[model samples]
Target: MLELFKIKKNHFVGIDFGTASIKVVELSYVDQKTILENYGFVELGLANRGNMKPTSLEQVLNDSLKKILAKMNIHNAPAFVSIPGFSGLVAIIELPSMPAEDLTKAIQFEAHKYIPSALDEIALSWEVVEKKEEQGEVKDNDNFISKLKLKNESDSKSGEKIKVLLVAAPKKDIEHYDRLVSGAGLEVKAIELETFSIARSLVGDEPGVFLIVDIGSRTTNLILVEKGLIQANRNIDAGGEEITSAIVDMLRISRSRAEVFKKEGKDILNSNESPLVVPVLDLIVGELHRVISAYKEKNKGSKLDAIILSGGTSKMVGIEEYFAHALGEEVRIGNPWRAIAVGSEMAPLTKALGASFAVALGLALRGVEDYKKK
Candidate 1:
């Protein structure tokens, strides 16, 4: 588990742990825009799979942190790390109108019904989604005075109800991340789930409806966001390593060599490219298709407006076109740094690095306390 450092806010560092690599981003406040201080990534020596144990992966994470921090000259800044979705649970639930004091209890009670872990062993948090009132008297409680006034002044009818999204994770998983950060000599101010972080960095204030497909090294996460709120999410058990493995088996090459081919698109023709690459790509697209179709079926009237791709594996050549072709929709690679300031000389590299740092950038964005309060 990672340790949290108590300090005054000046800079923030976001660290993302992926199956094939780890990314870190350092940011500082500038005039009106958030300036990018420094950013770098470390490739993991091992890839995550069902066969890999958590203990072995923890060591790799520790070593990777040491190298990433040293190379970027980052030491002792408040850090944010994201927990993988597979290790926790996230759900959206409808709760009856209640005082803010009772919301926490309501969320906890609801969590036990949705989360597989014991209620006492989980850490939880939730945000209220305000709905137009159809019929109800405005209460003057100290906790909700502002909300009551806003609701009363609105044109909504009495007794109308709104929906809220609740997110929870097991305490054991939180402790595990805390231990890792503490071991690495970094403070963990907050722990965010990767899906939420990706949504934050990719979607931001974008309106309407959009789906974010995060193709990581070991898992592919699908997130549906509407009006800046996460409406649905799912994680698939496939990622970049599958593509690499296919290349390795087809070309009869070392894992390291296959990884190079996967990234550089080198020696692809020499190998049985179509039989290997085509199927892996098709599998990824197929899973995405299923997830999207299910989302559409569940939503009924809602339609997906766009598709944004992020994560390390999303950098594969022709992937954007592949998704666009399969989904028959506009698919764009996400730029995590779109809202942050960067030097012109570094623009090209920043664009390349943005996709990989979606979660990390979102984590760092959280550490920007002043900006968030506004």
Candidate 2:
């Protein structure tokens, strides 16, 4: 299990190792602002050029990190890394109010119900989201009676309950990512689920509930966030690859060509190729509806503020409008760069890249947040 809250430095790098590519963002905190220092990425398939033998995933990642760091002139910076959302669990648990120490033991007992793996095989971290105090009277030795007072920091309808955010990942994954970064000569400051990283960068301190639909190359990660905390999480086996496959089958084009068209294609819903893409998009939309319904049912009176579209597939033209119409919410492409300061020259590239670097930006922002505390 990785530490949920670990921050010791201001200058840090966020590395997001995605299925399609590995993105790195370097950031620093200055004058109460998070400044974007540098960023780079390399596609996973780039290692096999021409007739070269296929490279091992680990070796490809190692070589790519060395080249990217050298090219960017970055050295010895501590790093925060992200594990895919599907690899672990992010759950909110409720229990009777108790001291932090007691809550820890209670959380462990509750974890056994959610996690199928043995506790020893998992790395676990949790945070108390909120606590409710109960009012009562207790007799002490029949000579004196004490009245219990309650303080509620957050609004709640229930009595004497504690809500906790539980995060866990396999220890094997922690070691694998640690080796990847340490082998590249960077100290690993922290490792967190990409779900939280995306939330930090995209949702920030914004109020209200937000559903972040991150459509990566291999899978789609759906996260329900409330007041910047994750409340629910779901993963779909479909993603951008399936969309590209639809295009390939419909238009009879090579996968390489379909990828290019997927990015360049605009108003595709109105085009003849709509049949090729709409079904796959709708599959994701269907799941989104289910997640939204479940959240709304669980949290009555809470309104969904917006739907944020992210990841590589989110760059598809007209996607914002598509989701807006489908979900009937204020759907927008998430601009993770909005929270950070950027140079005029980098604006165009940043806008083009958009939320594709969300996880990385959020990872680096985590370090910047700690620096501000100092």
Candidate 3:
């Protein structure tokens, strides 16, 4: 659907390292568009790995990557990867008139208030979310305090206090990823937050209010986006694993069997599994309501236009209808493939795996952009 971009790249890949699986997508940009070249995925075997050590997880992840890389016939491509959704902190901090160097220092000083640990303990990134008015209409100045003459980030002159989205990730986590990517013989072009990557891949230049609920194996991430920028995001402990556990407990099935049932159960709406899975789904629906309500309250009852469902668990049967019925909004599975071109032969695979590959697609798109700038 994104046919207007005019850029070309020969080599680009995006890898998504999630709690339960690793997904990778290889794409090439040609003729002013993005087209799917190749893609692959492998389960990390972390779904039911209770009390798994970080070291062991790393080893297993590397092993899985080796297999998926071989399967895709991928060797040594510039790569962009995703950070676990829950691993970092994102905050909106306001800063007034200041020099470029001073703004950096101010962000560092203000970061401590949001990040629990020392500022030096993590890598920090921030972007200015400036509020701008078009042509003849003047936006409410309540939120637009004033704009300052900024040399580096902006050119506003009304002296508005700019809102910055701050992101901080632990240094050790990044180091671990660096070693992991290097071990696979791939160059690390960049690393980014999974939510932002999702926005880039699925929401790509769309100016609308959207709430994306990505139900992964270990966590469910709720992200609020307004006019193409992330407004608020939260990653909760509840996800597919919790539902699997419930099924395993009530159905008395093995973890592996629960996984299969959770994925393939067709009668989830009215079958025996309903008794076991309804409570969890209902609770998630309630949480969705709370997230939307909070965002609405913060933005003067700004309504959510739609909910974009993503991740593996979002593929569950009846999931869309269940959420749509409960949330009273349009709920549909996200099409990460919409940004790229694919043949009819891959249509079924895309239909089945589109949501799960969202982060990887986003990583590749962002990675491509970053690569061109170099």
> Which has the greatest TM-score?
2
In order, candidate lDDTs are 0.72, 0.78, 0.74
List the candidate 1 regions with Cα displacement exceeding 4 Å. 1-8, 47-56, 95-106, 132-161, 266-284, 294-301, 369-374
Per-residue lDDT tens digits of candidate 1, residues 289-343? 8867877887798778888999887788777777787778789999888888888
On lDDT, the stronger of 1 and 2 is 2
- Cα displacement (angstroms), candidate 2, residue 227, comes to 1.3
Per-residue lDDT for 264-344 in model 3, tens only?
A: 857574345454555656777888888888888877957788899998888888788778877899988988888688878
Candidate 2 lDDT over residue span 182-290, tens digit each: 8887888778788888888888778778999999988789988876667888888778888888888888999998888888866665355544555668988999899
- Per-candidate count of clashing residue pairs (backbone under 3 Å): 25, 1, 5
Score every model by TM-score.
0.81, 0.86, 0.85
Predicted structure 2: lDDT: 0.78
**Given candidate 1, what's the lDDT at residue 152?**
28
Clash pairs, model 2 backbone: 1-123
- How much lDDT does candidate 1 score? 0.72
